[model samples]
Target: MLSRIGLRSFRAVRNPVRCLTTKTTITDHTTGRVITLTDPNRPEIADYPNPKPELAQNKDPYAKYDDPQNRRNLNDPVNIDDDLYDMWSPDYYQFVSDKTALKHNAIFFSLVFGFGAIIWYFQLNPEKPAMPRSYPFGGLAKELGSGNAEDDEFYRVKPDTTAEQELGFLDGDKDISSAKESYIQQNADFIKA
Candidate 1:
């Protein structure tokens, strides 16, 4: 019975010892340093540095009644109308106000119309021929069509011949027919071989 009681107390002591053995790291804010603690019996507190004198002395430099620089002029303030009129003069501040208003108005109108123009441009039909409808494939299409007369796949695989017409190589239906004949004659070796 006594041995069992001794074992129970030993077990309790072992659990508390394990809990106390856990370690923690802490930082000291004052000196920008770190410290570690492992004791469970005492609470740990990290040391911090005190505020410096230069940082603590900062105060408002523009306080009206208490300002050191303006203290001498504080007692001489009897010209109320003159001071108020001077402060309220439209002529004194009109230049900056007018310039800013003009700038803002110009920016507002430019942005409004600029965005509308962009939206309109995007909304237009993409497939419709743009004003003068210039062709892009040019003589390559005409050459391919005439030279590959025996090979139908060449004409079918090539791009449109509209580019040659736009480039003035096909001034009329006659010119287009003649170009087709010329292409076949000039490239006979390449086409037949």
Candidate 2:
């Protein structure tokens, strides 16, 4: 260990360091004096053996294109009527807006009529009941008013034979038959919807 430490110290003392330094001299013309400065810590800048050549400036590109024969042909200007963009002409802008409105209205009405058709289709149940709903007839009618006891038995009502007929033409009509009563009892809930 003592010999190794001695060798390390000897190697450190034997090596010589190369320091990069620069010196510059400047003159102050006004004061008529000269100054010299040195930078010891700066690293030496690498210099290229061959530097890039400077590029020449380009001339005006438009100067070569001065011939009128080389120019593009211009289109003829459009001569539109004064009313074209106004409300009067056949090719007016309002026509576009009117067409768009018509298209939207058509779509809206089609959707509404389509939905109505669907609802009407659903309302007409294929499994029609045996008895008419209105007094003149019996299976299904708009049951909007308060119905009498003689009316067709629905989802909630119990069939009553003794109930009076309120309207004039319906007064002398006979009671519902046993077959009709049984059918009504069986399909009461199905018809209500």
Clashes of each: 1, 6
Candidate 1 clashing pairs, residues 3+ apart or interchain: 30-49
Best by lDDT: 1
Could you tell me how far off, in angstroms, the CA of residue 60 lies in candidate 2 after the best superposition? Answer: 44
Q: Write the per-residue lDDT of candidate 2 for residues 1-193, one digit (tens) a residue.
A: 5598887667655753333233444443434344443322222321212222221122233443333332212442222222232222343132468789999999999999999899798885364344333432333322533266454445223322223233223533345576677788899988774
Q: Considering only N, C-alpha and C atoms within 3 Å, which residue pairs clash in candidate 2?
A: 131-138, 131-139, 132-138, 132-139, 133-138, 133-139
Compared with the true structure, the alpha-carbon lDDT of candidate 2 equals 0.43
What TM-score fits each model? 0.20, 0.18
lDDT of 2 at 6: 86
Question: Which number leads on TM-score?
Answer: 1
Model 1, 1-193: lDDT tens digits are 5698888777665643222223454544434445554332332422222222221113244645433542313444333233333323333432468789899999999999989899798885365364333434442445456455455555544444565355444347888899999999999988974
